[model samples]
Target: MRVSIDSATCQGHGRCYDLAPDLFGEDEEGYAVLTELTADRDVPEGREGDARLAAANCPELAVLVHEQVRA
Candidate 1:
């Protein structure tokens, strides 16, 4: 799974980082940032739930989780 943030919709609520620190972080102005170590924003093997949790908790609904579509 992969995650992303919609900058325009985010309001610096900090819930994404608060709920999933490993997957997210805050910018200087307190905006949601993808904190994953990889540049592709890939979720770790077992951390798909963390990504989903962050997306679910975002008040602005800015966090987005993308799962690989099954063929």
Candidate 2:
């Protein structure tokens, strides 16, 4: 899976980072940061659903989750 964060819509809520620190981070202003742009493997063992939940929970809906299909 791939994650994208829209800086414009972000309000520095830090919910994403809080939910999945390894997958998401926060800038100085607390905006969500996409920790991994490309992944060779699946979402971390226990973080799959958590990450999705975090994105959905964003107040501004700034987080986006995409499933990458390999050939």
Candidate 3:
């Protein structure tokens, strides 16, 4: 899974980072930031649930989680 944050849509509510600090982070202004230590920001091996929770809890709907489509 891949997760991303839309800065424009983000209201800096901090839910993403608060809920999933392992997968998300906050900028200097407390905006949602993708801090995954990977190129594609993969949702780690087992933190997929955290990512989903963060996205679902985002009041601005800024956090986005994209799962691979099954063939």
Candidate 4:
């Protein structure tokens, strides 16, 4: 799975980082930022739940969890 955030909708609630520090982080302004994940945005093994939880708990629904389909 992959994850992303809609900056246009994010309101710096910090729930994404609070609930899933492994998958999310906080910017200098306190907005939710993706942790050190690569540019592909892949959710590391064992962290999919954290990604989904962060997405679900985002009050602004700015966090997004993208399920990747294999060939």
Candidate 5:
């Protein structure tokens, strides 16, 4: 899976970082920033759930995880 944040839609609610710091954080301006595990990168195995949860918990729905379709 792939993780990405729509910075334009972020409200800086901190839910992404608060809910999944391992996969998310804040930039100097306090906007949501994806971590190394998923910062403009692919999701590690077993951590897609966390990414999805973070996206779901985001009130602004700025977090997004593109699920891979296994053939």
Candidate 6:
């Protein structure tokens, strides 16, 4: 999976970081930062769905989850 954050629409709510700290972070300015965009790393079990849920909870809809398919 791939994650992308739209800084323009973000309100610095920190919900994404709260839900998925390993995958998301907040800068000093309180904007969202995407720490991990790929699923190849070692993520704790069951956290993947939580990340998606966090993205869905964004009121501005700034977070995006993209599933990659190999050919």
CA-only RMSD, every prediction: 1.6, 3.2, 1.7, 1.3, 1.2, 3.4
Can you write out model 4's per-residue Cα lDDT over 1-71, one digit (the tens) per residue? Answer: 97899999999999988888867888899987777772468898878888889889999999988888867
Q: For each candidate, what TM-score against the reference?
A: 0.89, 0.73, 0.88, 0.89, 0.90, 0.76
RMSD of 3: 1.7
lDDT of 6 by residue, 7-60 (tens): 889999989888887788898999988775434433344566876887888989
Clashes of each: 0, 0, 0, 0, 0, 0
Show where candidate 2 strays beyond 4 Å. Answer: 36-46, 69-71
lDDT tens digits, residue span 1-71, model 2: 66678888999988888877877788787777766521433466557687688888888998887766668
Q: Which TM-score value belongs to model 4?
A: 0.89
Residue-pair clashes, model 6: 0
Q: Mind giving the per-residue lDDT tens digits that candidate 3 earns over 7-54? A: 889989999888777678888988878885423778777787888899
Please give the ranking of all candidate structures by lDDT, highest first, separated by commas. 5, 4, 1, 3, 6, 2
- Full-model lDDT, candidate 4: 0.85
Judge candidate 5 at residue 25 and give its lDDT. 88
Q: Determine which window of 10 residues in candidate 5 has minimal summed lDDT.
A: 34-43
Off by over 4 Å in 4: none
Model 5, span 11-66: residue lDDT tens: 89999899889899899989998888776668888988888899899999899889
Sequence-dependent TM-score of model 1: 0.89
Q: Candidate 6, after superposition: displacement of residue 61 in Å? A: 0.2
**For this target, which candidate reaches the highest lDDT against the unseen true structure?**
5
Clashing pairs in 5: none
Estimate every model's Cα lDDT from 0 to 1.
0.84, 0.74, 0.82, 0.85, 0.87, 0.76
